[model samples]
Target: MAFSNDVKIKALVACARCCCICHKFCGIKIECHHIIQEADGGSNSFENCIPLCFDCHADMLSYDDKHPKGTKYRPDELKFHRDGWTSKINAARPADYCDEHRKLDQGLFLRILRRLPWNGSIGFISTNNFAGFSFDCRALLDLHELAACNDDPSWEFIDPTLEIARANLAHHVSRFLGLIGMNTFPTDNPDRNSVPEEWERERPEHFFQVVDEIHEAASRCVDSYKTLLREGRRRLAIESPADEEPTSKPKT
Candidate 1:
């Protein structure tokens, strides 16, 4: 479901700066963005969110082709001040958004998750104590072409339930990584500047790239899932006789 209006307002109200692109600074005309996507299982919770102008949002959406869950600045990219604004978003995010696609089996959903490369696993969060890719993306395995982790024994689907659990875990991890941007190494994204370099050279293509990447990953995930049901053993994978697929992940 689309995020609620109430959530939107709360997010906007917390804005610290106007959007870099549009100069808008409020929710009605401007917009708020979670560094991590609420759809990617990122929480609507304030800790992982940011408010921006519609122009800035548009700019970011056009910033890269590989962005689906949107992007995040690297941890070290932000600036710190005297009052103690640490300049780091919590960077926590959920692993999946099964609720958004309520027409698939657990196993198939997992097959899709397996195919998606966990880019965030490189260095995305500080969960309680975790840092620099503290988690294992190998366990978040599946099958695919464009973004496979190429882990053979690394991915072994047990039953449908276990597979779903693994995918759910992967969903959160992906959310975490995407919330931190393409690289988690040091969060080196530049701060709010007048204009960035990429804007001049090939911006529209960059936006198209983000669109393509998200579509490719999401489409691949959805498409493979259908195949999973036919060739696999998730109860709901069959054409007719089966159980209902599970719902959203446990609230994280």
Candidate 2:
């Protein structure tokens, strides 16, 4: 079966584009091997696929002198190695490696900034205005982005500041959606009016307060991201040399 780009990306992300057996990165190319061969009744699903370098793939399908040539490797053995390496790669992911997630976070922050009032009062803004915040923002800063982040190790950095900011925004958006008879959350009381009874009691003052708090929290996350980028760049500069030195000095 021909592999789709989505399936290939999923496999690469799961194994970090490395060979499952020898556990070495394949650089640009890695072959997608079926954990259970399709010829042996294996479907072309995600669970049935594994990423391997050409050499490792050959080794998996071959038997050395220690074993008879006719004997082939078992699927479970390959699966075990793949699972172990996937876990190690995910665990070793750098804290500041979330470029895509960071972009989504920034996108949502920009949208929120646009909606906020110049006077810092959200009471004037209706709940209907921010409903789109729940939509997936390129696999970050959205309700569904969590699944993407979970699947991709590179996007797994959990910035506490970003979490707090997102939670603040989600709370406000969820409350607004809840008040409008939308059932996105179990806590949503759809029986209430559009404005909700509790919020009605708090009125504009509570609305303003929530807006101010969320804005401040999200702004802090932005600053934290900038600091993280600076630290990461500085570390890279120190760890990597600008040019490679000669292995031996001149013979003169």
Candidate 3:
């Protein structure tokens, strides 16, 4: 049988609506997973329930015992992780927990800044024409890495305002990357940027439309990133580097 409302609510509350395994704040995007499958006689009790995010829930269920590629998460391990995380969440005061989250979030924002430096390719893409502009392959890799981290549970901001800003930045970054991937082609020169796809020549209007979309998307990414940086610094007390200028123009 499925977990009852009481069991689900209790598990979610114990984990503060965060994934028990990754500790990512999931809010409404969380599920109460059974530690032991119901088919295996797992009861619909709070003790058998573990709150998890959508991705973690999928991973938890993907273990193929017969065709095992790697070690699967054991039931004992899942219980340990759930109990440990829930204990921590239930023990800490709201203010203290938020303080710890703020510190971790500062580091996360710093990592993001490193990937998208103020005078780096992101800024360049925001200001330059997309017609002949090519983004550095390495920069694209950094963006991909940053995008991947959006789902990572570690270092998720607990502050609602900061979380909202982070989500906005992630959305814009993903949009920018999607537009580029669809419209660009890799070049032989490793040091140079990827060039626009040859198909653009066959459909000039469509190409222009994509170019405008890309430019707008890039601008939104930069704007959202800057907003995150400002909010993180102000609310989380993040320190900016002395040599780095957050307001500096993109490198020409």
**Residue-wise lDDT of candidate 3 within 188-219, one digit each (tens)?**
77555543556467877777787778767877
Candidate 2: residue pairs that collide: none
Ranking by lDDT: 3, 2, 1
The whole-model lDDT of each prediction reads 0.36, 0.47, 0.72
Which candidate has the top score in TM-score?
3
TM-score, every prediction: 0.25, 0.36, 0.59
lDDT (0-100) at residue 167 of candidate 2? 32
The C-alpha stretches of model 1 lying farther than 4 A from their native spots are: 20-27, 65-252
State the lDDT of candidate 2 residue by residue for 89-195, as single tens digits. Answer: 67554365477655554544444333332222222221112221232122122422222232233332233333323333433343332333332222243322222
Indicate the residue-level lDDT of 95 in model 2: 60
Instruction: Give the poorly placed runs of model 2, Cα more than 4 Å off.
Output: 63-67, 93-246, 249-252
Candidate 1 lDDT over residue span 1-252, tens digit each? 444677665544333343322222233556555555655676665455455545446654575647556564431231111011212111111134244322444434454434432332111111111221122333223321312432232342333333333333333334333532442222243331112234325675654454344334333343333344444444434342332332222111
Evaluated at residue 4, the lDDT of candidate 1 is: 66
Candidate achieving the largest lDDT: 3
